[model samples]
Target chain A: MSLKVENLSFSYGPRKALDDLSFALAPGSFTALLGPNGAGKSTLFSLLTRLFTAPKGQITIAGHDLGQAPLKALAALGVVFQQPTLDLDLTTRRNLLYYAALHGLRGPAARGLADEALATLSLTDRADTPARNLSGGQRRRVELARALIHRPAVLLLDEPSVGLDAASRRAITDHAHRLADRGTTVLWATHLTDEVGPTDRCLILHRGRLLADAPAGQIAEGTTLTDRFLALTAETA
Target chain B: MTPDPLHLSPNIPQGGPGGGARPPGPAAGRYLTALGAILHRELARFLGQKSRLVAALVRPLVWLLVFAAGFRAALGLSITPPYQTYITYETYILPGLLGMICLFNGMQSSLSLVYDREMGSMRLLLTAPLPRGWLLFAKLLAGTLISLLQCLVFLGIGYAWGIRPPLAGLLAVIPALLLTGLMLGALGLLLSSLIRQLENFAGVMNFVIFPMFFLSSALYPLWKMAEASPALARACALNPFTQAVELIRFSLYLTPNWPALGWTCLATAIFAAAALYGYDPARGFTRAKG
Candidate 1:
């Protein structure tokens, strides 16, 4: 397993946020974590990223336990937070280089890797542009590019397509799929079923419990994804 | 055709189940690079913000030029240890104003930290693969560097205003200023961990900066405050800002104030430790929603 969460539980004071959540991701696999708003998806992401510690659970990333070896676990993981994390004042390339330096890559090594990542994302043209100048899609692409600079083993993007137009959304979704195909274990969290492919592994979470865990097509049964998702969440809603 | 950037070659280590892809574990070279990167980012931000520099200077300049000039006569001064001869009130408050520069800059850095937390940039920083204490210290050091620059600029301006300490005294003050800057910046870092929202920072400025500045030796000597009220004088003596100002004052005259130096160092260590604890994932506000 590239990433594993075993019996994770967390609470925000008296209110439980995640309840006995457990899952594991193999290397090179793409998984879609589908959940409605307030279904503990963000909470799960927070736990996975170690933004908040799981009061009861074990999270192992790339063979390193997050609680035991946080630096190693975090080094193998890449993240794009739900909120915009880019420094708007910095150019796209500068932002990438800054993240590279954070991961102990600098000088010519960092610059060359940054260029390759930019080129891979087809963001080379916008490399010199300040993040503020780029459109929403471009900024998201830059963030994805930044996440790839260190070649993390596991990539986690939380609602990365939020607020993007349809075309940009599809482009970003396709790019994530391509990344998973290239052997980067990816966990893309979103409320939108359209982002999940038929062949991808899908986890449906509702009210802090895993409702379904299987291939996207199997999870849907005979109905469409939208129908199955609504059906699964409707009972709790 | 170019290989996909996301593709891993067979030669590269895989972090699979029991895979031998150990992280570049705590290398000194990596730690230095991270520290340097963090410092560089801060320096770049400071240089980019002309308004921040102007805002930091305006308060101290106002106190020195207008408030000092107006209060010069009303505030009578006795010969203090750092002072051998009778000096103008502006001369007396020069060190205090320098302290003011650092105090305000410290809070300003704290305010930015809160803003960064809100904006999500802080997450990028906190997730870096380094010791959290070292990262926080790097942040404190970065803020202190900016404080030092502002102090130098203020000193240049004070020279123009005709308040001249000895050249040796000026050189001696550098270490004092550096220590004071770190102490105050650490206090700010601790406060940043407490302040959850950017809007709440203004309240901190009024509640913290005002009380710290007014209750300290920044504006008046502890002896002067004692004459007015023994209780308030005790409070002033205990204010870490008081020791910081006194340290700067003694250094300005090439005199060593051991007590003040000791007090400031103790304060820095305590504040930095508390800040680290506050940022701890299990205990502190970092767990709270940004």
Candidate 2:
């Protein structure tokens, strides 16, 4: 497994946010972590990203154990958090360069990677534009470019498509699939069913446990992913 | 599974900051790059927010201009070690007000940390292949640098306002100002880690900043406090902030106060370590929720 979570459990005091959840993603796989607002998907991402630690479980990213070698694990991982993380005053290229430097790239090499990332996202023209001046979708794309600047092997995006228009949503979802196809392991967390294509892998989570883990078409009892997701969550309730 | 070399993008340039074959973990070169990047971002942002610079300078200016004029006749100072002859009350309180600049700026830095943590920007920072301690230290250093810049501005304003120290005194106070800034920045780092949320800064401002500033010898000398109450004098003397102010005060007159330096450095080290422990992931630190 390129991205692995084993027996992960978390809580806010006594109330469990995640309970014995376990899952893995193979290389080149794009798995939509489908869950409702309270379903602990963010908790799982927090654990995976080492923003928060789980007492009971282990997280390994591209063979590096998070507990034992966090730098190595994090080196292989790229994250697009649910919230907008860009410094509003900085240009798009500046944000990517900053991220690249954080990952050990610098000077000419860092600039090259920044150019490549911006070019990959078709944001080259907007590279010098301040983040606040950009549209919501453009800013999100800038964030995506920032994540890619260091070329992390495993990408984790929590609700990356949220707050985006329909066209922007498709562009992001399509770009994520393209990255997966290029052999980067991706775990995209979102509640929207339409974001997950029929061919992509899926994981349905409720409360704390993963209720379904299969292809999007395989869940829902031969129905649409939205219906299947609703039914599985309702059944758990 | 190890990260496949083939999976590494061709767009990735060959050499990292280390200038040779890449290591799998955080390297010293990586640390410096990240630190520089963080500092650059901070300076860039700080420059963009021109009002912050004005706000940081204005508080002390008000005190120096208005309050100092009001209290000029009220407070009289004996010729201290740094002061060979009689000095105005404004001259006596210059270093104290500089300390105030750092104190507020440090807290402002920490408040941004809390806000960043709440807004999820801090998560982006922490996800880097770096130790949390180093990152926190980088943040402290950045805030300290900004505080130093503000101190320079305040000192320039002071010189213009006829509160000029000796030329040598101005040069001598840089190290003292730096040490004091670090100590206060570290203290702010500690508080930001312990404080529950961003909303609690109001309490920090009133309860922490006010009490520390007033209880120290910032506004008045410890001797003045002694004249009022021995207990208050003891509190003023015992305050670490008092030590910081004294260090700056003596340095501004080109004198060294060994005890003050010792206390400020010790306090800085202690606060920094506590902040590191507070932010350690093994402790299962709080994750800002939606």
Candidate 3:
């Protein structure tokens, strides 16, 4: 499994944020984590990234246990948080290089990979542009490029399309799909059912519980994903 | 199960920051690289904010020029350990004002950390492959360097203002400044971990900065405070900021203050320990909604 979670439960004081969540992603597969607002999607991402740890679960990334070996586990994971993480004062290239160095990729090698990542995103011309100067779409693209700089085996993007224009959203979604096709395990979290492909694996989480787990087409049955999602969530809400 | 299947590219390694051509684990070289990168980022951010630079310099300048001129007659200094002769009030308060630079810069860095958490960059930093303690240390180290830079500029202005320490004394004070900066910076880090919101930080600043500055020898000698109130003098003597100022004062005259040095180190260690614990993933970061 590229990514795996078992019996993951978390709470904030008296409030339960996630409950007994379990899932595993195979290599080279794209999975859409479908959820409504406040469905514990961010909470789960926090656990997976080791930003938050639960007392009642296990998480493994690329065969390394996050709890026992966080460095190794995190080394194989790439994440674009729900909120933007770029330093607005820093140039796109500088931002990428800084991230690269964080991952222990430095010197000429880090610069080379940063340049390649930017070029891949068609952002070479804007390499020197501070992140504040870029459009929202371009900044997202730059973040995506930075996420891939270390050639992570698993990528987790939490609502990456949020606050983006329709075209930018589609472009980012497409870019994630392409990454998965090239053998990177992807877990793209979003509420927009339209972003889920018919054949893609889908997980529906509601109020901290996994409600459905199957192929998108299989789960939706005769109805569209939007209708199925609404019915399922409304049934449990 | 196959050992690995995500072999999309032959040229690029599948491992991230901790993998591939990089060292096996958090090796010395990797730690140094991360440290260098972190410092570089802090420098870039510091340099980008021209207003920050101006404010850092201006605050101390205002105290030295305006405040000192007004109080030069009111405050008189007898020959102290660090003072070779009866010095002007401006000369006596110079070390205190220098300590002021580090104290404010330290608090400013903490404010930025709170802001970084709100903006989500702190998450990116915490999730790095390096150990959390090392990352925090690197941040503290970077903030100290910036504080030292501001101190240097302030000292240069002091030179023009006719408050000149010996050349050897100036060289000797660098280490003192570094230690004091780290001690104060660690205290700021401890505060940042406790105070979650940027708005709450302002209240803390008023509470902390005022007490720390006023209750210490930053503006007045402890003996002077003792004359007013022995209780307040005791509080000033116990304040780490007081020790820091004493350390700086002694170092500026090539004299070593062992008691002040020991107290500053102890405070640095305590504040740093609390900060590291507060930021532990299992504890502080998890409790706070980042």
Candidate 4:
């Protein structure tokens, strides 16, 4: 398993966020976590990335228990948060190098990985440009490039394309799918149905609960994913 | 398209990363790299914001030129342990101003922490494989470095303005300045953990910086405060910042105040521990609602 979350629970004061959420993903699979606004998607991502500790459960990344050994567990993971995390004043290459260093990749080796990630995103020419100079789509691509610089076994992105145009959104989604194809377990969280593919596994989270876990085609029954999602969420409501 | 067939682990030599495909516990090398990266980014950010440098220098410069000059006739100085003769008011307040610079710069760093949290960059940092305490230390060190550079420049300008410390005292003051800066910076770090929003910082400044600066011997001597009020003077003597200022004042005169050093060191330790604890996810605040 690339990722395992067991009985993860979190609370923001009296309000419960994630309640006993448990799921596991195999290596080299693309999984979409579908949820509406305030469905605890961001909360789940935060726990996986270790931003907030889950008070009641265990998380293991590629055989490393997060609670027991955070460094090794975190070393095996990469994350792109729902918000833009780029330092706009720094060049794309500089940003990548900084992230690579944070993940323990540095010097010529860090440079090589950053270069390779840039090239993968067709951002080689844009590498020297400051992040502020890049378009929204290109900036998001740079974030993806930064996340992959460490070559993490599992990658988690929470709403990776929130403010991009249609084309940029498609490109970001395609790149995420490509990362999965290269054997990196990917957990993508978003509310949009168009982003989900028929063959990809789907985990439906609603109001801090995991309502369904199956492939996209199976979640929809005979209806479309959009309708099925609405029906299931409304029923729970 | 890719050089290494293994997607998770890129090829690294023995001394480098152990095995890319499930690299072992982040070794010493990785920890150093993480520290270096955070420092480099902080320095870059500091240099990029020209306005910040100006603001840092200007605040203390105003005190040295305006406030100190205005208070010169009103404040009298006697022969003190740190002073060989009666000194000018600007000279009297110079060390205090240095303390002010570090205090403000420390708070400035805390402000940046809040900004980073808002911008989501802090989240990215929290996710790094290294320990959170190390990351916070790197940040504090970076802020301390910036404050030291500004303090040096301010001291040079003070020398030009006819207020000078002994040439040998310059070298002696470095360790003092560094310790004071770390204590104040760590205090700021601790404050940042409690402040959840950016808008609330102005209140913190009014509630924290003003009181710390005013209650300490930054502008007036503890003896003077005692003359004004014994209770107020006792509070001033007890304040950690007063100890920091006294430490810097004596260091600038080539004197070592062991009690002041002890107090500042203890405060630094306590503030650093509190800041690290605040950033802890399990026990401290860092959790966000979905």
lDDT, candidate 3, B1-290, per-residue tens: 21211111223333332233343444787888899999998987888888998989998899899999999988877776888798888888889988989999889988988888888899899888889999999999999999999999889999998999998988899999999899989988988998878889878668998899889998888888999999999999999999999999999999889999999999999999999988888878546682
lDDT of 4 by residue, A180-202 (tens): 77678899999999899888899
lDDT of all predictions, in order shown? Answer: 0.86, 0.84, 0.87, 0.86
Q: Write the per-residue lDDT of candidate 2 for residues B40-76, one digit (tens) a residue.
A: 9898889888998998889999999999989999888
Model 1, range B34-61, lDDT digits (tens) per residue? 8898899999999899998988899899
**Could you tell me the TM-score of chain A in candidate 2?**
0.98
Give the CAPRI rating of model 2: acceptable
lDDT of 4 by residue, B16-86 (tens): 11126333453887778788888888888888889988888999999999999999999988888889999
Residue-by-residue lDDT tens digits, candidate 2, A107-200: 8878977887777777888889988899888888888878777777788899998888776687687778878877788899999999998878
Error of 4 at B122 (Å): 0.5
- Stretches of candidate 1 off by over 4 Å are B1-26
Error of 4 at B241 (Å): 0.6
Looking at model 2, the pairs that clash are none
List runs of model 4 lying over 4 Å from the truth: B1-26
Give candidate 2 regions above 4 Å deviation: B1-26, B288-290
TM-score (chain B) of candidate 3:
0.92
DockQ, all models? 0.37, 0.34, 0.35, 0.41
- Candidate 3 chain B — worst ten consecutive residues by lDDT sum? B1-10
lDDT, model 2, position B79: 81
In terms of DockQ, which candidate is stronger, 1 or 3? 1
Q: Fraction of true contacts kept, per model?
A: 0.33, 0.40, 0.41, 0.46
Residue B75 C-alpha lDDT in model 4:
90
